[model samples]
Target: MDAGAAIWEYLGADAPVADLPAMGYGEVASGYATTHSAESVGIIGGGYVGIETAEAFAEHGLDVHLFEMVPHTLQPFGAEAAATVEDHLRKQGIDLHLDTAVEGIDGAGSVERIGTGDHTVPVDLALVGVGVAPNTELAEAAGIELGTTGAIANDRYGQTNDDQVYTARDCAEATHTVTGEPDHVPLALTANRAGRAIGATLAGDPTPIGEIAGTAAVKAFDLEVARTGVIDEESAAEAGFDPVSVTITAQSRAHYYPGGEEIQITLVADRESERVLGASMVGREGVAKRIDTVAAALHAEMTVHQLSYLDLAYAPSFSPVWDPVLTATKVLHGKVAG
Candidate 1:
């Protein structure tokens, strides 16, 4: 991996907000928290990083005020599904401000308060989690091409334009299986796989990196959120597929089982091809593994019909006669036919 990237400051980009000068210069501060002792903290952008960091601070007895311009926290999960996790965040004592714009983060040398146009929240520190762009300065100077996502351009084996130079991890893009195109995922899992493939290539064994599964998971207090593949109708359409989506609520275990939890699954499939496009899940337990099953199906390019008949292990205490995953695809398959 190269130098990775810095947090992008996108608030009030064109017009300067009072004391803040430019996008990256101010309106926010740059710092990550392994731990902090401040009484109150203000977090900008309620995406993955912002929500997790807010949860961590709330658990440590620090007052947290999370601000997001969007109506929901997790953009990938959609507003409806993301609301479930947002509810839990509020119950955990995190002050959430939805559909709120922060004008600037101002202080002498450190952040003292965040001005959001209508109100100002006092904060000892501010963490910005807007997004990142790859550090390709040196690579660009060396005549290396950059992808559409502004990340370093490289082949599947981490070989750059110059055969003598190689790069991997967050700096480069990977071929997404769904789109059959290069995308900047920058997740640790993809980074690790790319690193391994590059090592094999250097050892005289050419190991072209496999396609990305487009999988990710995160825990929000009591809820564990997992999703993979396309999941959104717009994305599926942009990738050249007629998308069909369905949502189902199922039990995590047999009805007769003593301990079980409610699992909400939203599955998307191709309308014409009946192929499983993507899926998302929100629940307390059995989340990480269930999403992995779908991730494997995505890797294998399984259709909705095939996924419906998957021979997953089942036990009264562990899973119901028909697992939640099967229930979701079986429903989606019917819709595909209809």
Candidate 2:
């Protein structure tokens, strides 16, 4: 919905909009929601939402062009992971335009072309998935205070500044476990958990929700991309850690296993404390669940060295003797110790 509004705002005209209903960020947009068809389509933003939407349209037989203002897509997952997905997208026939911005949209009654200041791509439809903002109008109208994130100021119990008012879901603020600062992540799981905690609190049980690591997963073509905690160098630094990271490619199963798959793991840790700050993975299989394991480690405040020694399950058909997570941690342990 936010993405659709941005497209109309950029075009400066009211145009027919098409909504794509997707389950989470990874799943392809369901075809049931698409009421119209186009020969060519333009997508702005190269993040998870944009990438999935682009793939969905292309699969429906439309020529799709994607634009990203940054040098690459999937910025949240960092550069190397972005490069991996970029290679896959190009191979899948997506016309990618990185380091590019959509300056305007031109058409008569609907979208026809997308302008990028220097160049234009002819398209029958355009989709914008840049980002979303908190819906704070009602809170503002009620005179409830908002945090620096522009989200409704709420305590751990999900109570707004006014004792009688409360906010949750996309409009509420939650604390980041590592940074210890309020952040508005607005993910589905976060909202659901926060709602549960708030319900418990209102019932007089007073269960406070713990801080979150902002974990997420997305599927790009055949690749399962997942990240947990703080993988971005800048975010890690801002959280008061001198970040060191290492990326390694390892097998998902035993070396001799017939169906073994390649898994890429990037581990980030603090140079001084050696604590594991975050991790990301991209693979054909076994990516999403592994990221959850890393998220649990982050919640428990485990160090990279500790993760390297974790007694993870191992089987010929499931994981290597040293799981990819442990393997990456072992390599990261050396770097942090050195």
Best model per lDDT: 2
**Can you give the TM-score per candidate against the true fold?**
0.86, 0.88
Tens-digit per-residue lDDT, 118-184, candidate 1: 7889887677887677888989999988888788878988898899877886888888877777888
lDDT of 2 by residue, 291-332 (tens): 988998998889998888788999989999999999999899
Give every collision pair in model 2: none
lDDT of all the models against the reference? 0.80, 0.83
Error of 2 at 202 (Å): 0.5
Model 2 misplaced stretches (Cα beyond 4 Å) = 1-37
